[model samples]
Target: MDSPICLIENLNGTLSVNEQAIDYLMGLEQKIVVVAIVGLYRTGKSYLMNKLARSKTGFALGGTIQSKTKGIWMWRVDHPAKADRAIILLDTEGLGDVEKGDSKSDAWIFALSILLSSTLIYNSRGTIDNDAVEKLQPNRYVTELTELIKVKASSGASSADDEEGSGSQFVQFFPNFVWVVRDFTLQLELNGKDIDADQYLENSLKLKKGFGKNISDYNMTRDCIRNFFPTRKCFVFPFPATVEKMQLLDTLEDKQLSKKFSSTADTFCRFIYENSPVKTILGGKTLTGRMLGHLINTYVATINSGNVPCLENAILAMAELENQAALEDAFVMYKKEMEVVKALFPVDSSHLSENHLKSQTRSTHAFMERSLKDTDGKYSAILAGKIKEYANNLFEENQDASEKKCKALLDKLSATMDHGVKEGTYSTPGGYELYCDHHDTLMARYRAEPNKGVKAEEVLEQFLKEKSAESSSILQADIKLTENEKHIQAEKNKTSQMAQEKAALDERH
Candidate 1:
């Protein structure tokens, strides 16, 4: 356990500056993700961490673990690509040592804490039966660890699970274990007696006679762990030679296990992100789905596609529109509220530092940036409003001085184009040309008179009547077609009636 802690301290020292920088970036709406690097002491934990640090920036300045503090400590590591985002790794101590009493107690406590906080790393060099697994009597540490594993595994946060402790008092809590066998090299111990390493039956029979009930319980624990964490998270590592290795130690300082660590780290942090209860509450408290849909529509249709100089220009446009500051403040408030949300949710998943959250996924910060730029986050509306404004400006600037001048220009343009839509022509402004297009298409079809089953006059009259009824204002509607038509007559009568009612109402007032 101290190994993981020592690793944490070293990682912390290496990552401090990067952490500060990331903090600043996140203040400007960035995200940072941090992961914990855990394994037994002297298992190259420090060496591997140092290598990772060199690939990043300098060493994190956090000191060695004191006897008083148990378990792993967390520290941020620099990310070469984006300084604003980083991976923070935690170091945990090795398990099962008898010489150091205080250290042993600390290790168990620390391991238990890791169990409670992190997605466990059953780190091993080669074979599983080392000094670590040999001392498996009934103890509090194993009980706690078993319980913690169950919690993480059941939540879909872990890939492997263990079910070996059946009928035992503490079987319920032992989660599936994973064999994190690194640099596979097999070593077998011999017992000077007639015992075959390959033969499990003989070995069990021998153990039953020699070790009694204690061995049985040990076997139970061992079998449980083996069955639970049966899958392999195995990797091959090249071992260095003697003097050549001594010189290459400097190179070791620069080498990192990012390829090896990335998947584990992603799973760990994601577990924290998913299982944390506050996320549920936050999700529930979101804007209504209809409002969010409208917002997305506005964003995609208008703001994102609208012409602006840059992010700054967009900001300025939003400010001019009067919701710029509100947008920015909304994002900031969301971040603050999310932090509180994280605190409320106890992540019994993997223990990840803040840096890992940002580094692992670039989209987190990208989303934040987009949200900040949104004017009330009503993106679709903003875009539509901007386009409408631009069109209005153009229409105002290009206006004709008098109705006669406008009508003459319109007539000339109409002559050049077909009565119905030609290949291309601008009639009405905006997409409201759908109305003009519909009318023109009807008129063209009416003139063709290819079909005889339906009466042209009747069809034309019905179309005009429907259009007139749908029209809210007479000036905006198509008022005149032929001089004598029933639809036209009806509209004229409706307009006269409306005028008379208005005149009477005005007189009474």
Candidate 2:
């Protein structure tokens, strides 16, 4: 899209999906690499998102303390590194906004970001110290995640048991975690030894030994980050411009920004473009933008109903919707391909059968490309049955077409012969020889005609049988023929009729 749109709107603590955004997502067929950013209000989250999108004007970047982006805003851009994939940039409403006065809503937003993204960027200003860690502690966002999302639908077990099991599985579904410390001024060193940004982040997340309320609180957030995310990365950005120019950061040219800041931004974008994986479910079924749209609707509906969204239930629901779409797509492709062969009606049986097999194969491949979680192959079986039925109908139509065309050709060719027989033109003294010669010439002309279809011989046999009585009468009236020659002619006619009957039988088989 040229610009971003609000994907989810949060108004007075109520969240609703935006139909326009959902429709846009539904139209996309490429696999998505979703990267979502979340942090406190006015943390330059939107600015980073715009940079990632490779556009300065796509995501709204506000200079004031007030959060400019409300709810979740989505921008879709072509992936720089992967030709077959697209990148979806989500700029969530800032967390911990005092004006909102709704921590519950913030928690949901946080949870949704984690649920939807393939890469989660936790943007924060200043250093990664105890206060920053505390904001991410169990008392704030990390611990509440277990309460906000469920791995499965409820059983008869207790809530505590369910939470325990769900916590262990978070890493299986959670996105890769990235910590972005904006306007970082401190040296990257610990105990007089210089370290990289990643090592510095690791040192900051280190758990303090011993047990106490403070230590436990400190360790909880660190442990949650380590356990829930399969991978973690860190990036530190120096101040981009002077205070006077900071408010106009989005408007400034790249040359106006600090060299270090611009270089770091480039590095960060490169890392994201190169490393972020396509969104996938538990079975490693990659999610296209259309599937992601369904996922958003499923989660939001569950949240609106006051129930925690279950991963398993959402996947099942999405599978049903996507599988039906896949089936229709495959069937449409099959019909489209068959239409080309249908135009050439009355084709040879082997030719028609060969085209049918090829179309069926292409349709099956189309279905397999989009189908997911079809462990029982139920959809595949249904597609096969539908294609088979369509093939049978086409074969019957071919037979009907062949019959019509062959019958029309025979009627046109025999019109003159029928008129001559009715006028007694073949009943004279030497007329029997003339009649035999004319019939043989007509038979040769009929056999020489092209494109008579598979029932050619059968139709000819029927026409010959219908004329046998007329031929016998003509032979008896001929006065010039001897008795022995007439008997021989009768026997030859009988043999010819038998031979025609056998040929018609072979064609049918």
lDDT of 2: 0.89
lDDT tens digits, residues 2-107, model 1?
1212222212112111233223323332233333334444344434444444333232322233222123444444444555444334444443333233333433
lDDT of 2 by residue, 164-188 (tens): 4446778888999999999999999
Candidate 1, position 366, lDDT: 37
Q: lDDT of all the models against the reference?
A: 0.36, 0.89
Residue 194, candidate 2: how far off, in angstroms? 0.5
Candidate 2 error regions (>4 Å): 137-139, 154-166, 479-509
User: Cα deviation in Å at residue 282, candidate 1?
Assistant: 14
lDDT of 1: 0.36
TM-score of each: 0.32, 0.90
lDDT, candidate 1, at 182: 43
C-alpha displacement of 325 in model 1, angstroms? 20
